[model samples]
Target chain A: MTAMRPDLERTASALFAGAPDWTAIAESGLPRLLVPEAAGGFGGDWGDAEAVLRLAGAAALAQPLAEAMLAARLLADAGVALPAGRVTIAIAQGRVTDGRFTGSAPAVPWGGASDAVLAAVGGELLLLPPGVATPGLSPAGEPRDRLDWQGAAVLAAGRASTSLGKSGVGDSAASEPDLLALAGWARAAQVAGALGAALDLAVDHVNTRVQFGKPLARQQAVQQQLAVLASEVAAAGMASAAAAAALDAGGDCRLALAAAKLRANLAIGRGVAIAHQVHGAIGFTRDYPLQLLTRRLMGWRSEFGSEGAWADRLGALAVARGSAGLWATITG
Target chain B: MVAVFALPPFAFPDDSAALRGDIRAFLARHQPASEPAARANCWAVADPEFSRALGAAGFIGMTWPEAYGGRARSAMARYIILEELLAAGAPVGAHWIADRQTGPLLLRYGSEAQRRRWLPGMAAGEVFACIGLSEPGAGSDLAGVRSRAERVAGGWRLNGQKLWTSGAHHAQVMLALLRSEAGSERQAGLSQFLIPLDTPGITIRPVIDLVGNHDFNEVFFDDVIVPEDALVGVEGDGWRQVTAELAIERSGPERYLSSHALLAALIDSAPQDPAVVRVIGELVAELWTLRQMSMATAAKLAGGEDPVVEAAIVKDLGNSFEQRLPQAIQAVLAADLDGATPLLRCLARLLLVSPSFSLRGGTREVLRGIIARGMGLR
Candidate 1:
């Protein structure tokens, strides 16, 4: 797992080297990473998508890989056909009660851009048409699109009381292993990737943009920030990679994913800030790729439940288990 | 009054509760000593018996291959065991360093001979190791160490004094960081040696801590010769090797577990004390934050990345909380001390022990420097 992961990481890095348009790469790469051979995917696990996210983060590629991966899996599970080229998913809440599935998810990711929208409403995977309108205010920006469907079909359902139930779309309320692991894996990997990219961007900026007659990298303050950033990137990378490997191996991937996402979210946010701070005034401008990367990092951190969200989850696990149990669960 | 409150709910799979139950049952079967369980948080109990029991339960060396006596479980599973052990206050102090830190380091960097000889025993908790890093002249400034190991016939003779050698008196071996051959100033020509504690010409004396516990030691080596094989990694690569080792050392729940017992004591004893409540609430929040960072590092370790900086940050923050716990508790109790209150007693113990918080693994100053270096500020 360790040896293979590093090689996959390098592959991701090479794929995103100095690319002008990231949307293309994300559109293509995200699905390819998640697609299983049987379902037209790359036979990938949640871990692979995580690897892709980590790579994208390192390269500072700004696009929605998370949305794509989730949408693809939702479609695959629901037995819905996915668009060959570009697809995104929006997951909102709807009806689910006592082992039965029903309801609708409004204004999903790639609502306009995606050909089909996949959601789990009332314990069922529902492929709804992207409504042609927007939901109210989104924590993220304006809706990517609106979904309008006549009658979406239920492609598949693992179990009625299963975690991927209708209401469990955004996060599996029941801790469904498959979806839960995948979400955690993807977020952690993306955070690792973002940290990696932030480090690179910061390094490049520091090396090229001379300040005080020396590159920013030479400054003690800049160096300290970079040092910490590098550590965070390394840590996040390890966490995301570990989570992915666990998922691939079909072990308990939750705690790993939770830890990875929690740490990566915090690191990515701090990393983006530090990178921009080192870059100074010029980094704030939209023309610089730093801004784009920073925005993505920001968006990703808030996505899949924020830092506080993940932290609280881990803390609850620790506190409730009262140390011994927590330790056993974590180490098990 | 300190406001003590539970952390906000984190939405996870509901089955986490069931999983928690399974872990609890496993721990109960292995080590029934659940009370005074505070010691379990250290997860440093290197007792051969308990470790062997853990091995019997198939819990030790949890991410290692089966050939090495490991269960090869998921990182998460191992994390569960560590958390449980700490909470239970298991006397893992004996094998804590080896299992949590050195075992992994050896697996990653040890020679094949080193792995074959050490890994299995370590997995079974048969051989315990302590880190020998700090010196009287070198506390936070690891690069300033003057300890020397000179070449000799079929071996190397060591001459140096190492202080703050935790578990040194009890451990079978010590991974000592020293100068292999003298070089230009800081961090040059350094090396790490796996020194057998029972080697001739070596003497170890306990350095009783403020609490009068034999937790650390002072060791002197007078022409103590070790086989050439004792050298770990390459000579003069000690700086890099030690840096990696420190990253592992400082990056786990143990870094923050010291204060936890005191915190629990404080909260349980005075859950309604406004001051206690407030302090506990704030500390809990910070603890939550630190866990996020720490867990991420754990995940990274599982993923095979050495997150030196992230680990440093965790240590820095974790140790800070650990150091502050006593004060937080004292202010909460606000009791006039004949120093007799249960809170005061706990506070006193924590105060005495808290100084060791920054001292262990790496001092706060040293860690901060690493953090600064990581942040590109230094």
Candidate 2:
């Protein structure tokens, strides 16, 4: 299915274009859009949500939209009752020792602002209330808290749903969600969006800012750099779209998500450098909106899984499959 | 705001997998006896025998009309065959230019007579073609070509020198672009001529590459005459035709699969090395991503949409990935070996030939310039 929801994308852009309002996002019913209508929520598919998430990223909307959408899907998949208000998800290395959750989750997105936290443990999903752990912030000043589950009471806990295999939409009666893959998918979309924004800013800047009595865009070197940036953005966008489509098709999207994140991270590495170079002094300043998008790119790329980490995971999978099986692993 | 640069999601048709299996079986039976180091040449190595065998199996020009000896398959089917051939390092280079661009170009722009004369031979792998775009005076700046053709009584007389003409010596036909009007503006008076290489007053000399390969050549045409039928498309439409041809040239598996044999070798030889595995995984991931992009572009082209910007983006990034692959592998395998293994030997060959990856199709700067212009920056 095509991921072009022009109406939803326009609404998302208008709402998140400047300073993001979590209350507005929640009020717009966008956060729970992925939750099935049978579960008392809007029944939008992953393709629809992909549009909103990508626009949210392009507009540099600093809210918990992606986290909330992912958390709602995970909770629905685990058969947990949907929570009111904003929700965030975190994968923590903890255990249910003595009927109480005890572990630490570092860099939980919107951990402080979220009303509830869905912590994914080994083969289980734990719902933790807010203020149950110490909060932290990401490099971009987003609410990425360090979650300590020691002595925190779990409101609900259940075994995560195994893959439902390939089934059509509204057939969620069998499939379970993979929290990490969902989160990685969300981050990939955001990175793609941010790259898009950075590319736009760089292009605009190069075309307007004059150097040597002509627009910087006239310089072959500058044009080359911008072109490279655009290519990376295009590639990242494609990778992210592929992953979203895979998830939408009810397939195990771990491979797609891994590649998406890897490619997105690589895009961020080159995209941000060229963007900043194009904008020069203004891009480095706080006044320009370029930093808002570029900063998120830097922060979001390292979240869920860094490039090296995902590369390691993907590489391990490839090695396990061996040379003979490599092509099938990719195309299958 | 820029319409979100994206390749719409796409996959091969249902029958492609079976077709892929058939190709794999064919490859298993007909693999060359070359070592992995030689196979590392990938799609760049020319082998007419292998090409003929592939054509015998009905793999070449599968997308053309059946009347032209083709199977009239979908573009995705052709894509599958090409990708499989390049991935396995099959020596289809002898027919690559004809199958990929020349045959398609003629099908799109050539007259009925030209198609009837050339299509079946190309589809049967009995004809080879070479592009004559870059001239001695004009490289990336194609508009600066000094090659000129003058109108004669029944045809045109051509005079020009083409540089870096791959397979020119081996090709039966040359799709040469020449400026036919002396005072016309840039990109205005160019026209394509389908010249037979055996025409009188044409000379081809080898331009040995860094790796000592004889694939590239320089061809000079002095007062060469061709019939009026040699003109492709309407006069003065060569710029548009060549531009369209490049989209086919740039957005193919050949752009990125040049180092695939090395990659396969690396995966086979160092499956346990963590550093090597990580790099290989990253490469594989990138490769998959690029293929998806290229496939999406192919789908768009099949749908009659001109994805010029998208094709340029793929070629630029694909070239960068391939050109840097050897260095990345060298970093991971930090051992001073004297071609002790096939992996090392492949690595050496890739290192020598990698520089040409960006130079071919289009240089990085030229591609990026096209991309920037597409993004409205220029």
Candidate 3:
């Protein structure tokens, strides 16, 4: 299967090129890429949508494109009518009693700005209207609002459909497409993209920045550090791509996504350090775009699941599989 | 913007599974049952008998020409065999150097007569070789090699000392790099010689490593005489040839599999503690990722691409993972240790040998330097 869509890629880059142009993205039909054509949306699969997510990540696009795509897929899967504007998903833990949902989801991506919020609660999908979330900002200054739905009115609620189970058409095996595995892979893809941006910024900075009568890139110390950073980036990219491919193939991808997120987290820990080290004081400034990508990397790594959480999950799975079956599990 | 390094997702051929199964079955038959500590040696153990068995099984010289007593298999086939041998902690060191590097180097640059004379024996695992690159003064800075080879009546006279040469005492042949001309550029004037360890005036003395093993040696070539055919490739091409060989040497399953025995032991005996599980899980994930990258590099080599940068990346990361594996396990075992378990023994042995992980092949610093240049930074 093709791993890229040039048309969607171009639209994503052009629309989210600078500040997040949410209206432009919506008008360009990019948000409908993951929604089924039967729902008056583009008839694209997850593989096609990954191109948009990856490009949005590489450019450090400040929009909630991944969340919007996930929300559309979830709504479409739940057989709910498409919303008018942007949508985001929150895998919240709450109970639905008497047609009211009461829960608090901290740090929901684009929760305040989105036209609708699709919260997953106990195997059911609840579509909540905007303005229910108290707006907040992540450390990276993105719209990571604290969504509180204490007896909040639900626009639509239903069992999130498993018709797409194991088909690779939707994101996860759970009734909702916004489970940890799906979110982990999505964030891993973004982290991979941000790493690319970091590498680019550092490489360009070192090549152009001069010191001691030569370019800083000529220094062995700087060169070695940059190399280490690049290797981490390469590794994170490979892991993320492998996870995406596994998800697209409808394979058992929990382990792949865990590994990808673990690797991505490790890469961010090393990659951001080296990027700033190579760029020196200038990289730490707010004006530099390097901070934009690096900050997002730090934020995305903790979302869906932290490295520790995934590591625990993966480790438990491995132990359950035992040593004799470990190699086969990994290689198979 | 510069394109990121793309390790395009790829899979091994469908038949790789059968090859893996065959190797597994072969290991079940001939694999040695060593204690946990000795098994930690993994690829460092030199067992000529085991090497011969591997050769007889068509595991060695797999990708070489059939005329050279090779099976003419694919690179992935060779990768499968090597990884399996390494993962099982088998003793394949006797022919590891020749099978991995010297054989390929000869096939690429050796003359027809040279190939006809040495390739068959090497493919048969009867011939063993050790690299002679480092000296007392020049370990990573190879261009500073002080060894000299002067033209004599029927051949050349070699004079120099090679230090920290692994498997040299057990090797039948030594690939020595020497300066054949004076007052040339740093990388110029260097030549490679296929010196027999038994040649006159060559003294092979053991240099024990930190692990109390005699695998390393110091070879003193005091006016040793070698025939004209002992010269590998062409004169003044040693630097280029050695660099090409290193691309293969640095990228392999062996680089990361040194501590795998310990990891397997840990997995087999690990408790269900959440903390321990996290560490083990992280290790497994990293190992899987490294294998994917290494296999991709192998595929590239099979396709005849140099992949120097990619190989260096693998070695650097693999070495880091291997060196830190023991300590990571140690952290997990802090609260859960009972002492004298197989896991403890494996960890103890790994701690001793892990220091050499970053030293052998190439130092982490040197490998990073190569990677930087590959990134167009230098």
Candidate 4:
């Protein structure tokens, strides 16, 4: 199908936008979207997840929607019973000693607020209840805390034989990179949404806000800047969505994630500069709605890794393929 | 408020892979002998024999109706063939304009007789065509065209000049825009005529480009006469016709793939240096994203909708990507002007000619203006 189900997308958008609560989200089955429909989940693929995350980002929702969806996936892989209320994931190896978990997971999204955290230590997967956290604020003022679990009660624990991370690495070991890729992909999807929303704001402002006897859009310079910004937004959104499609198809997931995140990250400053430039003084104000999207764009751009980190990873991959294989790697 | 722009993932046809394989096989055998440098801007370089071979293999006018020597294929299938040709740097200049825009325009706007006259020969790749939109003072400002065509006995008498008519010397027909309605001006009272290049009182002279290429020409029409049926679509509808035609003109594989040869050359020449690798990686990421956007646009076209905004977006961004590619490479990698390496030569030639990338088809400013208008900007 060339189009997404607009009815389902509208429902997801309604559920995720503007401070949707955990009970509402859980009831809507938004988090369980990745799980199979036969298994009582929404039975959506990664592309669907990409669409929801974009809506969440466009609304600049403070909840850990991405993490909750990811947690459902990890728990499904581990054959753990679905949890009630909010869930989150930490792509770190927590220490497991005699059936209890210890150690801290950094930058866990809404970690203190989640009902449970899906984590792994060594080769074993573990689902632990929410832990006490020293919260750190994201650029958007959202909670991304250093969530500390000191022998926290393990709700469930087991080995996921074939998991998301295992495909990147040969063994069934918990590979941090692939897990991080999943995280990066979610952020990339969110960035795409945020950029589009931001561009809309900039376009509206340019059309309405006037100076020198005409709307700002009447100026050639303004049009050029907005055009470039629009292009960046389009590129970022497409890259992220395509990556989700590639990941769903089980084809070159790592490269897709890397490219998606790198492009999304690179698009941020270029877009922010134009959007803020076009909006003038009001865009820079604290009370303005434009800051919400721009700040989240900044947050998402840095979350998985910096642009340099992704560029380095992607570059090393191209080098391994060599000159001749590079084209095949990209096109194939 | 109108919904924000969104580009969903393109659902390619089920046979995309098989089609791609077939094109690859065809290209490997039918490819002409040319310098490695020729592939970078292969779409502009003519190879009549190669075009004939492609036609014989049933690649030209691929999506046209079977009655016109076409296979009656899907537009997606044609997109695959186009991208494959571009990726491999195949020279497609001989019939590119005809196949890409002129044929499609005629199929939409031409009389049945006109279609019967040109469609078969074009499908066979034996007939070539060029666009005659820009005039002496009408580059991006096409509305400023001063060319005039007067109604006459059994025909229309045309007298005008068109500049930057690419492939005019090699083409059999010229789709020229002229001022048709007397005393009318500015995007009104204009008409398009499918004039034969060999018509009486017509002159085609070469206009060499910065790269020393003679693909461009100045076409002069001094009282040239054509049958009344030569007017495509309706009189005084050239403005609307050409605007619609630009969607086809700007939204093709050529926008981004013109310099693909240089990208391949860079990859072949690059080392394991981190700086170079980082550059290449960013390039790859951007290219991949652009491919997605372009494919989405193609899908829109294939679905029988002329996506004005999407097509402009493709060209606006695609043009920037191609035009900046060579300079980006040369900044990271040193190249001597006298260097004989493929990468070095591609870089030099591309740098010299890349300025035209954004200028041709539609200028970046023009594309952006169209996009801005589509966005509801003032």
CA-lDDT, candidates in order: 0.63, 0.82, 0.81, 0.81
Residue range A113-209, candidate 3, lDDT tens digits? 7788877665667898764678888768898998877787788886554533554433344443335566777787888778878898899999999
Q: Chain A: TM-score in each candidate?
A: 0.77, 0.92, 0.90, 0.91
In model 1 chain A, where is the ten-residue run with the lowest total lDDT?
A160-169
Superior by DockQ: candidate 1 or candidate 2: 2
- Considering the two chains of model 3, state its CAPRI-style docking category: medium
Give every collision pair in model 2.
A136-A145
| Candidate number achieving the greatest lDDT relative to the actual structure | 2
- The superposed Cα distance between candidate 2 and the true structure at residue A330, in angstroms, equals 1.6
Judged by DockQ relative to the true structure, which candidate is superior, 1 or 3? 3
Which order, best to worst by DockQ? 2, 3, 4, 1
Q: Write the per-residue lDDT of candidate 4 for residues B237-331, one digit (tens) a residue.
A: 99999988888877787888888888776666646677777877777777778888888888888888878877888888888889888887788
Q: List model 3 lDDT by residue over B199-298, tens digit each.
A: 8899999999876889999999998999988888989998999988888888899888889888888777757777888999889879878987888788
Which segments of model 1 are wrong by more than 4 Å? A1-33, A58-63, A83-86, A96-107, A135-185, A208-215, A251-257, A311-325, B1-88, B94-133, B142-355, B364-378
The TM-score, computed over Cα atoms with residue i paired to residue i, of candidate 1 is 0.64
lDDT of 4 by residue, A1-332 (tens): 12444666899777766477767777777788787676778777788888888888888877787888887876775567789777887755567778677888887788778788876554556788887788888888888887888888788876543565323321343243455677788898898888888888888888888799999989989988887888888888888898888876664566778889988997897888998999999999999999988888888888877787887777777767764476555556
Expressed as tens digits, the lDDT of each residue in B249-306 for candidate 2 is 8888788888888888777664677898889878977998998888888898888988
lDDT ranking from best candidate downward: 2, 4, 3, 1
Kindly indicate the candidate among 2 and 4 with the higher TM-score. 2
Please report the candidate that would top TM-score against the real structure. 2
Which pairs, if any, clash in model 4? none
